[model samples]
Target: MIYRADPARYDAMQYRHSGKSGLKLPVISLGLWQNFGGTRDYPSAMEILGHAFDAGVTHFDLANNYGPPPGSAEELFGQVLARDFRPYRDELIVSTKAGYYMWPGPYGEFGSRKYLTASLDQSLKRMGLDYVDIFYSHRYDPNTPLEETMSALAQAVRSGKALYVGISSYPEQETREAHRILAEMGIGTTIHQPSYSILNRWIEDDKTIDACGELGIGVIAFSPLAQGVLSGKYNQGMAEGTRGADPRGSLRASHIEPRVLAAVDKLGAIARSRGQSMVQLALSWVLRRKEMTSALVGVRTLEQLKDNLGVLNNLELTADEIAAIDEASRDGLMELHPRPSGWLR
Candidate 1:
């Protein structure tokens, strides 16, 4: 049965401006990155998507290489759009990204003008849409000039294929250059997606958040849950079949170190007192940043989606609470990426 979103949904979900744009996006956005592609549950994906919208999550984030087969997540979401969400397209803030290893050959990926343009076309075809609400360069390619990639994104807006453009995982310096280049083209960046959470705070030193705020660009922190580490799920060790167990899922296994588990246990206890799950605490923690535009989260089930939405209701963290969190999770991300000067891999 086709489900309709609750009309009162907007009453409960918090909204934030997309930088200086007229748009006001939900404080929490959904991203289809890891488990929404091949070998994942499409029905659960649809359920999560539907539940997200019904709970006032209007923004959906995706990328070109977000599937087991790469590009399958967009195709899967396109199927959902065609089957259940065709009429509500205008009500949704859909975004997709390029600039990673998508297709073979030199021209198929990276921040080059040719790759970005072609990738958007392919992404649009996959999503069954003429235009996405926002398109992004996905990453910063050191080899490609900022002007070249920025120009392609600007052209996407002018050509009516993308309403706004953003960048992801860009270093602070590169992001500043990108904003300048896009401004020269008369198109301001609408958003930036960074990895930020209690366990991963790259933006702290990068100053990208302040940069975006100054440039009138929105900031959406992806992996705000630290890829589920902040969820209190790994305290007893990763479940028999979970992110740590899957070869495709393993990226930073040190995330579950003994100290990390102990910290999560303490955080989880505090969350229990607040009558919220650790996931909710993590989500709320990210929302505590006034400079944060949105929290782009990933989910594997409808229950997870529902659990995360509760973050909006009890977001008022006391100053001491914030201090406790800071004290508990000190320098969590620094150890994960010991080499700050090295490229993100």
Candidate 2:
């Protein structure tokens, strides 16, 4: 059967302007970093993507090296687009990045124009896209000249391969420089994708969030649930299929120490008091910042995706609730958690 999107999709979700740009993003954007890869169950991915679009998620985030084998996520997403989303292409905001490791050789990765340009071409081909809505640098390549990276992003826009350019996980100072260089190139920085949640507040402490607010670069927080820690799944103990049990997963048992569990327990209590689940509270807390344009969530199942979308129904976080989360995260939460190593392919 041919898939037709709901006519009332726009009415299902609220949209926010990305930074100061005219483009707007659904408050709950979907990230294809995990289950959309080629190695994963294709039918499951199709279900989630279909439901997400039906529920009004317009933005779908991807990267060149997202899958376990790398690049497969784009390959899979391309298939989905051709099959079910071709008619809705104009309404969707599809983005991909290239700074991380892709191919083997030295020039295969990082911020070089050669790598970025070639990677985007490959991505466009894999995703069957004429041009991506946004292309990101993926990370700060300290080894490469900042000018070189920014110029490559400019080249992407100049070549009409990307409508906008952005940077991810860049420090405040570096973010300022990149934004300046992009403006000089006549292409304004669109948004920044960072790892932010109650457990990980480095963006706030490092002033990246503050800098983005001042510079007018929108922030879409990835890992807003802290890699499932804030989901309350491990409050009692790690389950068989949970991230804590998966050897290759980002979350480890050590990450859920007793102190963290206690914090989660307190948070769960607060969530119940508000008639919301732990995941909903975590997402609402992240979106509380006026500077936050959207929250990028990765869902493994259709139920999880729907739960994430339901957060938009009640985004209000009371002052006391916010303070409670702050107090709970204050102790032992200062440890630097591992962000996706942008260098790793």
Per-model TM against the reference: 0.95, 0.96
- CA RMSD, predictions in order: 2.1, 1.7
Candidate 1 backbone collisions, by pair? none
lDDT of 1: 0.83
Runs of candidate 1 with Cα error greater than 4 angstroms are 334-345
For model 1, the run of ten residues with the poorest summed lDDT: 336-345
Deviation (Å) of 61 in candidate 2: 0.4
What lDDT tens digits, residue by residue, belong to model 1 across residues 1-345?
886777876778889998898778889999988878886766777788887888888999988888867898999999999988898899999999987787778998778999999999999999999999999988788787788989999999999999988988877778788988888889988888888888887777767778887888888988788778898788766686568767657346678777777778888877888888999888888888877889998887777888888888798888888888888776454343212223231
lDDT of 1 at 12: 86
Assess each prediction's global lDDT (C-alpha) against the native.
Answer: 0.83, 0.87
Residue 48, model 2: Cα distance from true site in angstroms: 0.5
lDDT, candidate 2, equals: 0.87
